[model samples]
Target: MDADKMSDLHEEGKNAINAPMLPIGTDIHPEDTLLEENAERIMLDPTSRENLKFKDLLKVLIDWINSELEEERIIVKDLEEDCYDGQVLQKLFEKLSGRKLNVAEVTQSEIGQKQKLQTVLEAVNELLRPHGWTIEWSVDSIHSKNLVAIVYLLVALAMHFQAPIRLPEHVSVQVVVVKKREGILQTALVTKELTSTTEMMLGRFERDAFDTLLDHAPDKLNVVKTSLITFVNKHLNKLNLEVTELESQFADGVYLVLLMGLLEDYFVPLYNFFLTPENFEQKVHNVAFAFELMQDGGLKKPKARPEDVVNLNLKSTLRVLYNLFTNYKNSE
Candidate 1:
């Protein structure tokens, strides 16, 4: 063969030997292709392979790249698994349903009252059933020649609490709605106040402390607010409380406290905290005070045996705190 043809054949041989198991997509850079091709050619040549030094060097490079790719795959698999998990699926369902159910905020022109309400209810029902929550809906009233409607939802909260032996009480959720003349709807949700344990733990904190933690929180305000409100709504009926302005503040406080605790327990030990020592203490104090407030209010008081509290893993609040802190530290 001519020189040029021989060179082309040699290149193709190298490409076949060094090509990744996965084909390169159209988006791959031309420069990367050239570099990879050159490296592969040098590694695959018969004379180069016989040279002990070159073979060892090529082996090391190949191993490093394979290791990195494997690690990335593992991480992606873990995240996918988490998204599929029941708890994660439920949270996503809540967020989507909550948005759809905001009757006052959603315009009739966008989605008719009935359609929006139906969608929200369906989403909630779908999620709840898998998590052992049975949902029941009832029409409260019909008005304007039955063109307008009102409905109520009762959700049975049956998730296993910290101790498998002692299950959480079944709670009821009530949602009220009034259809307007223009086919728009106004809605309100009511649930019982939190349990005595929750109230004691959450009520002890001064509102300002809760606000401070929220102000410094790492996540977006909307995200934090939504999560807090959802959590409160979930347990409100069990607690036997009406939703009020103070309840909003209390929910915010609970979220802030939980986020702070999460930060201390999970992220503080990470090497990243060393870079932000000054902020760490302030964050920790805010979390601890929040916990103290809850403890004082009798919200977080342990009902089971003293040791059960530790075993119960009632540290969800703490987990939130840690996630917030870690997210901020990582961002910095």
Candidate 2:
């Protein structure tokens, strides 16, 4: 009977191999996932600093995010449900990093929310990477409303941005991570720390050479910008794009994104971004997305904030262009 079942399975596989191809644009829905939920059972003592760590840090992070996004009127009551849709995160990042993200303001669908989460998290990781901070959460974990993971990310962001909130030093929380698989269930006790500001040792580096040159030497700055402009136009001409006003032109992030694709020999998907930004928010979002792409291509993350470039800040814009120029000056 086992041999007969094997033969039947082989025939079914053969039939599947010979099945007709589906037409383009067909909607292929995927099966539901196993709901990857890692439940965290907090073991708090309420008296010990280690025990009070999670509660103290959670309140600090929530307050910091609320204050940062007060103008947007986004109050993050719980990191789980409030952040699952990505709107709050997007706004928080814009306020922290001073850059708007090119994601939907409101995503109702699971896939849409996940996509936005991926973008926001990638940008967050890029910002944190230069500081030697490691990312502790994934899109799935955050989307699934894992409280522990959410708290970890918020703590990291708060510390990285130096949010004006009082977080206890050496805060640790004992938690049991519960997982079930293949009809088996298991739990592991983990001690997680709400890392303090001192533990990070994130020191700010000196301003970029371009920024310094523009400050002390205006004539030389013009010469350098002109040289970079010529280099930019040489390639941009291929796509009929020009950079007559480097400060104002690249502020929108459209030209910068296109220029990066041209020099790096990659395609910036149109659907992935807005081609014609309608407002200041969209412009900043485009610039931020460009910066992410630059980091993805192994380029050093620029020090300039996305909003700075969008606002036509000469030092910030020059810093970004100068970095690209130094890297791809000799490239075809």
Candidate 3:
């Protein structure tokens, strides 16, 4: 083969490996020809627990955006795909801030889209700066349709605006970033938070105390269990039931449901749940039902999953009970 032809083939091989996976019709960088080098990435284990929680946060954010932009007839189903152009983001900023943004409503060229993103993000940062907060996203990240960075920006915006969304507090996701830095392939697994703030600081304090009790202070843990047992029995005594082991007694979720009913002064209908759960699925059903009841009573939704409670996960069970205890400790 001719020298120039051989060189062209070698470059094609290199570009194929480095090309980013972008949606069709999306414009690439101006300097790039067939592909953008060092733009390829792989998100490891998309179905992991942490990733599932991250997906939940994404859904909540999308729902919040759709609700806010309902008047504009803009429904955002995919944050990465829809918001990358900056049209939806511009409208969202205008809606939340109650101020008009001087940006184009539609931009086909990449430069115009990026300019719109720059303007919107700068305005957002201005509003967030007064509260000692700044967005962790950039125009490049948003334009690249980075889901994690987009989520962080939306969460900060929601918190600053008090958008009335039920954000999942204290949730983090493991992200695998693979990039070529200085001609070397580097892979890093990073755990990033999906949301945060003063509320999270308090939650972290509570979690750290629980860890300290669990790790360095068995006696203190036992005292907490005993106090919780006393609290449980105070309400369960009406049905001639008692809790001896905080972990095992709450495993099946029967006592948990009864305790919530007695604590909140509401009767859970027998038809709504199995009075005597005979199988694991039924136990999970009972626990899941109990959480719905908790929400209905205007209590904070527990971060613990129903299956975790059914399996007697100590940390998950403790988190649910502790949330209930803190809220009703002074009530009845």
- TM-score of predicted model 2? 0.46
Q: Write the per-residue lDDT of candidate 3 for residues 213-303, one digit (tens) a residue.
A: 7768878887888777787787899889988887788888888888888988988888888788999999988997898889888986666
Best by lDDT: 3
Off by over 4 Å in 1: 1-105, 108-111, 138-285, 288-332
Model 1 scores a TM of 0.22
TM, every model: 0.22, 0.46, 0.53
- Candidate 1: tens digits of C-alpha lDDT, residues 1-332: 89999987886676555433322121222332443211311011223224453333333323322332353332222221232212222333343344333334333342344444444446666655675443433111111111111111211221112211122222222222222222222222223221224323233433233344454754554465455444443434343533333222332233344333343343222332222224434444443445554454344422222222223232333343333433444421
Give me the runs in candidate 3 sitting further than 4 Å from their true place.
Answer: 1-136, 147-208, 276-285, 330-332
| Lowest-sum lDDT 10-residue window in model 3 | 26-35
Give the winner by TM-score: 3
- Candidate 1, residue 120: Cα displacement in angstroms equals 0.9
Of 1 and 3, which scores higher on TM-score?
3
lDDT of 1: 0.33
Instruction: Supply candidate 2's per-residue lDDT for 248.
Output: 92
